[model samples]
Target chain A: MSASTIIFYILSAIIVGGGLLAVTARKIFRAAVFLLFSLIGIAGLYFYMNYEFLGAVQIVVYVGGIIVLIIFSILLTAESGSDMKKPALSRILFSALATIFACALTLWLIKQHTFHVNESTIIEPSVRNIGRQMLSTTEHGYILPFEVVSILLLAAMIGCIVIAIKIKPKT
Target chain B: MVITGVCLLAFLVVLCFFLGYMERKVAAFMEIRLGPNRVGPKGSMQIVADTVKLLFKEGLTPDGADKFLFNLAPFIVVITSMLVVAPIAYARDFQLWDINIGVLYVSSISSMAVIGILMAGWSSSNKYSLIGAMRSGAQIVSYELSIGLSLISIVILSGSLQLSEIIESQANGWWIFKGHIPVIISFVIFIIASTAEINRAPFDLTEAEQELTGGFHTEYAGMKFAMFLLSEYINLFVVSAIAATIFLGGWMPFHIGGLDAFNHIMDYIPSSIWFFGKTFLIIFIIMWFRWTFPRLRIDQLLNLEWKYLLPISMVNILLVTAMAIMGWHF
Candidate 1:
C-alpha cells in the first residue's frame, strides 16, 4: 500500500478506537479525553485530505471549543474519577443494535452514491480565495450563508447570556 | 526534517534556560534585590544547575492519582508548545513550516495546551491542581477569543494568514507603525490577550501561589514539574515571537518610506538578530509586566476579557476591515 493509504488507515484506526473508548470508558474524565482524541483524529483526517483550512476549523471548533466546554461541564457536575453507572443489559443491547443498523444504512448510502472528483473545479484552499469566496456576492459565493451563521451565533450568544443571568429576588 | 526537529528541540531547551535566567535577573532588578548571583558568575549557570537537579530528583505520582495521565500531561503540554514553533518565522527565509494556515494553526494548536493542563490537574487527584486547571481552562478559553480577534485584525491588514506573506506585506513599514490606530489597538490587545492566554501575571490566577499553591502542577515533583516549567517558558517565547512577527514585522529590519541611507544601514544587521531583538524586546516587556502588575483576581480577570478586551477587539476588527478595504494603511 502507498504511504498515504497507510496513513489514512492509521488515522481511521485512531478515530474508531478513540470513539469506542470514549463510549465504553468507565471514568467520565477519561471518556471526555477519549472523545477529544476522536475529534482530533477527525481533524487529522481533514488535514490528510489536504484541506488545511477545514482541518484547522475542525480543531478550533470541535477539539478546542466544544470538547473544552464538555470537559468543563463534566468537571463542574460529575465525580471525574468515579466509575459511571453501568447501563442495563437491555439498553446496551438496544444501543448495539441501533449502532449496527446505523452503520449498515450509512454503508448502503455510500455504495448507492456515485461520487465524482471534479479536478478542474477544485480551488486552492488558500486564505485569500476563502476570504474572497466567503464575502463575494456572485454565484457560488457563501456570503448569505456566512451572514446567516453569524446571526445564528449572535442569537446563541444572547440566549446564553439570558440563561446565565441571575434574577435578583425582591428585597 | 529530522535535523530540523532536533535543532528545534535544542533551540527550545536553550531558549527556556535563557528565559528562566532573564526572568530571575529582571525580577531582581525590579524588586531592587540581588537574585542568583552565587552559581557561576552572576548566576548564569543557575538554570543549568536547576535542570541537573530536576533530572536527578524522583518524579512522584501522588497516591490515588491516575499514573498514566499524570505522566502523559507534561508531554502533551511540551508538544503543543513545540508544535506552535513550526509556523513562527525566526528569521528571514527561516521557519520550520510555512503552512498556509499558519496563524490559525498556531492558535488552534496552542489552544490544545489547556487540555494538558486540565489532564495534569484532574489526574493528580488534588483539589488545588483541579482548581488551578479549571481556572486555567476558563482563562485560556476566554482570552483565546480576544487573541483570535486581535490576530484577525492583523490578518485583515495583511490579507493573508501565511506568516511569510504577513511579513512581506510589512516591507515598507511594520503594522504597528503603518496601520495606524486600529492596528496599534489590536497590537496592544494581542499582547494583553496572549499574555493571559499563556497564563502569565498579572493574569496568572491559574498558579496563584497564595491560593492554589503552585496551581495545576502542585502534586508534580522532579522532572515532571520541570516539564511544566519548560512548557511555560517555551509558550512565553512563542507568544512573544508571534507578537514580534505580526506587529513588529518578524525578521524585517526597521525601514522608513523615504530614508534610503538609514534603512540600508539597518539592513546590515542579520535577519536572525532582528528577529531575536524584536522578540526579546517583547519578551522583556512581558517580563516587566509580570514584575510590575499585581496578580488580578479571578473575577476581575474574566471581567477584563469578557467586558473589555473582547468587545474592543470585535470593534477593532471592523475598523481594520474598513481600513484594509479603503487602502488607508501605509
Candidate 2:
C-alpha cells in the first residue's frame, strides 16, 4: 500500500474509534475527551489532504474555541454533573445495526459509481495557491465564504456572552 | 537512517521526553538550585523514574463526576497536542506534511486543547474545576483572535501561510528587521495573546492551584495527570516554535546586513540546531512568565482581550495592509 493510503487508514481508525468512544463511554467527561481525539483525527486527515491551513484552522476554531465553550457550558450546568447511565444491550444492538446498514449502503454505492480517475501526479498543497483561488471571482473561489465565517463567529461570540452572563443576586 | 520514515512518531515522542528533561534542568538552574541530581548522570533519569511512578499510581474517578468526560479530558488535552506534531519542518526535509494551509491549521488544531480542559473541569463534578474550565473557556478564545491577527501580519507581509515559505521570506532578512512597524506591533500582540492563549502564568487561572485547587484537572490522577503535564510542555514548545518561525526567523542564520563572520558561524551549525536553540530560548521566556507573574482575574483577562488586544490587533492589521500596498516596508 502507498504511504498515503496507510496514513489514511490509520487516521480513519483513530477517528472512528475516538468517535465511538465519545458517544459510548459511561462517563460524560471521558466522552468529551473521546470527542477531542476524534477532532484531532479529523485534523490529521486534513493535514494528509495537504490542506495545512484548513488543518490548523480546524485545530484553532473547533478544538480550541468551540470545544472549550462546550466544556465550559458542561462545567457550568449542575444537572449533567454525574454520569446518567450505562449503555443497555438493546440500545447497543440497535446502534450496531444502524452502523452496519450505513456501511453496507456505502459499499453498495462504491461498487456502482465510477468516479473520474485522474491519471495525474500529486501537487504541492501550499497556502499561496489557496490564497489565489480564494481571491478569484469564479465558482471555485472561496473568498466570500471566508469573509462570511468572520460574521458567523461574531454572532457566536455575542451569543456566548449573552448566555454566560449570570443573573444578579437578589438583594 | 533507513528506519527514519517509519519511526518518525517514535522519535518525536522520545525527543519530547528529552525536552521534558531539558525543561526541568533549565528551570532548576534558572531558580539557582540543583535539580534531580539523584538519578542517572546529572539527574537525567529522574523523568523516567517519575514517569514510571505516575504510570503505576492509582487512577481514581470521583463518585459524582461524569466518568466518561473525566476520563476523556486528559486524553483530549493530550491528543490534540500530539496530533499537531505535523506541518512543522524540524529540518530541511523533515516535515510530516507540507500542507498549504499550514498556519491556520496549526492554530485550529492547537485550540482543541481547551476542549479537553473544559471536559475535565465540567465532568469532575467539582465546583473548582468547573470555574477553572469556565475561565479557560473564555481565556483561550479571547486571546486567539489577537494571536491570529498577529500571525496575519506575517502572512500578509510574507504573502504566504506556509511555515517554510514564511521562513524562506526571512532568508533575505528577518521579519523583525524587515523594518515593518506594524509587524512589530503584531508580534508584540502575538506574544501577549499566546501567553494568555496557553493559560500560562498571568493568564493561568485555569490551573491556579491556590484558588482552583489545581484548576480543570483537579480530579485527574496517575498517568492522566502526567498527560496533562506533558501536553502543557509540548504546547509550550509548539507555540515557541511558531513564534521563532514567524517572528524570529526559524533556521535562518542571523545576518546584520553584511556581518560575514557572524553569518558564516551561523551557517556552520545544522539548521535543526539553530531552529531548536531559538525555540527553546523563547520557551524559557514563557516559562519565566509562568513562574514570575500572578494570575489575572477572569474579568480582567476578558477586558484585556476585548478592550485592548482585539482592537489593537485589528488596527495593526489594517496598518500593515496599507504598508504592504504602499511598499513602505522592506
Candidate 3:
C-alpha cells in the first residue's frame, strides 16, 4: 500500500474509534475527550485532502470552541467521576432498530446511484479564492448569508445576556 | 525538512529551559532577592536539574480522575504549540512551511491548546482544577475575539494572511511606525489580547495560585507537569515571536526611506539574530508585565476583553480597512 493510503486508513480508524467511544463511554468527561479526538481525526482527513484552511477551522471551531464549551457545561452540571446511567431495554431495542434502518437506507441509496468522478471542476483550495467568493456580490457569492449569520450570532449573544440577567422584585 | 523539524524540537526544549531560568532571575530581580545560584554556574542548569528530578519522579493519577484524558492533556498542549512553530519565520527564507494561511493556521492551532487545558482541568476531578479550566475556557474565548480582530486589521493592511508577505510588507519600516495610528492601536490591542490568550499574570485567572491552588494542572505530576510548564514558556515565546513578526518586522532590520547609510549599517546583522533579538525583547516585556502586575479578578478579566479590548479592536479594524481602501498604508 502507498504511504497516503496507509495514513488515510489510520486516520479513518481514529475517527471511527473515537466516535464509537464518544457515544459508548460511561464517563461523560471521557466522552467529551473522545469527541475531541473524533473531531481532530476529521481535521486530519481535511489535511489529507489538501484542504488546509478547512482543517485548521475544524480544529479551531470544533476542537477548540465547541468541545471546550461542551466540556465546560459538563463540568458545570455533572459530577466528574460518575458514569452515565444505562438506557432502558426498550430504548436500546429502539436504537438498534433505528441503526439497522439507517444502514439499510444508506446501502439502498448507494446501490441505486452511480457516482461519477469529475476531475475537471475540482479547484485547489486557496485563501484568495475563498475570500473572493465570501465577499462577492454575484450569484455564487456568500456575502448575504454571511451577513445574515452575523446578525443571527448578534441576536444569540443578546439573547444569552438577556437570559442570564436576573430580575429583581420590588417591595 | 526532517532535519529542520528535529532542530526546531531541540531548540524548543532549550528555549523552554532558558526562558524558565530567565523568568526566575527576572522574578528574583523584581523582588530584590537572589535566585538559584548553586546549580551549575549561577544556576544556569537549574531547569535541567528540575527536568532530571521530574523524569525520575513517579507519575501519579489522582483517585477519581479520568486517567486517559489526564495523561493526554499535556501531549495535546505541547503538540499544538509545536504545530505553530512551523509557519513562523525565524529568519529570511528560514520557515519550515510558509503556508498560505499562516496567520490563520497559527491562531487556530494555538486556540486548540485551550481544549487541552480544559481537559486537564475537567479530568482531574478536583473542584479547583475544574474552576481553573472553566476560567481558562471563558478567558481564552473572549480574548480570542480581540486577538483575531487585531490580526485581521493587520491582514487588511497587508492584503494577505501569509506571514512572509506580512513581514515583507514591513521591510521598509516596522508596521507600528509605518501603518500609523490604526496599526499602533491594533498592535497595542494585539499585545494585550495575546497576553491574555496565553493566560499570563494580570489575566491568569486560570492558574491564580492564591485562589485555585495551582489551578488546572494541580493533579499533574512528574513529566506531565513538566510538559504543561514547558508548553507555557513555548507559548510565551510563540506569542512574542508573532508580535515581533507582525508589528516589528520578522527578520528585517531597522530602515528608513532617506537613511541609506544607516540602513546599510543595520543590514550587517544576520536575519536570525534580528528575528530573535526582537522576539526576545517582546518576551522580556511580557515577562516584565507578569512580574510587575497583579492578577485580575475573573469578572474583571472578562470585562477587560468584552468591554474594552474587543470594541477597540473592532474599531481599529474598521479604521485599518478604510486606510487600505484609500491606499494610505505603506
Q: What tier of docking accuracy does candidate 3 attain?
A: medium
Superposed Cα deviation of residue B281, candidate 1 (Å): 0.4
> TM-scores of all models?
0.95, 0.80, 0.94
Q: What is the DockQ score, from 0 to 1, of model 3? A: 0.74
The complex in candidate 2 yields a DockQ of 0.55
- Candidate 2 lDDT over residue span B51-125, tens digit each: 899999998899987666678778867777876666777876666666556787777777767777777887787
**TM-score winner between candidates 1 and 3:** 1
Q: Of models 2 and 3, which has the larger TM-score?
A: 3
Clashes of each: 0, 33, 0
**Using alpha carbons, what is the TM-score of model 1?**
0.95
Error of 3 at B213 (Å): 1.4
Find the candidate with the highest DockQ and give its number: 3
Candidate 3's error at A55, in angstroms? Answer: 1.2
lDDT of 2 by residue, A1-171 (tens): 998899999999999999998888765555666786788789789878766666767767667766666656655566555556777899989999999999999999999999876669654556666667778888878786888898999999999999999999999
Q: Pairs clashing in candidate 1? A: none
lDDT of 3 by residue, B39-141 (tens): 9999999989999999998889998887888889999999998888888999988888998888988898898999889989988988999899999999998
TM-score of chain A of each: 0.84, 0.71, 0.83
lDDT of 2 at B189: 85
Top-lDDT candidate index: 1
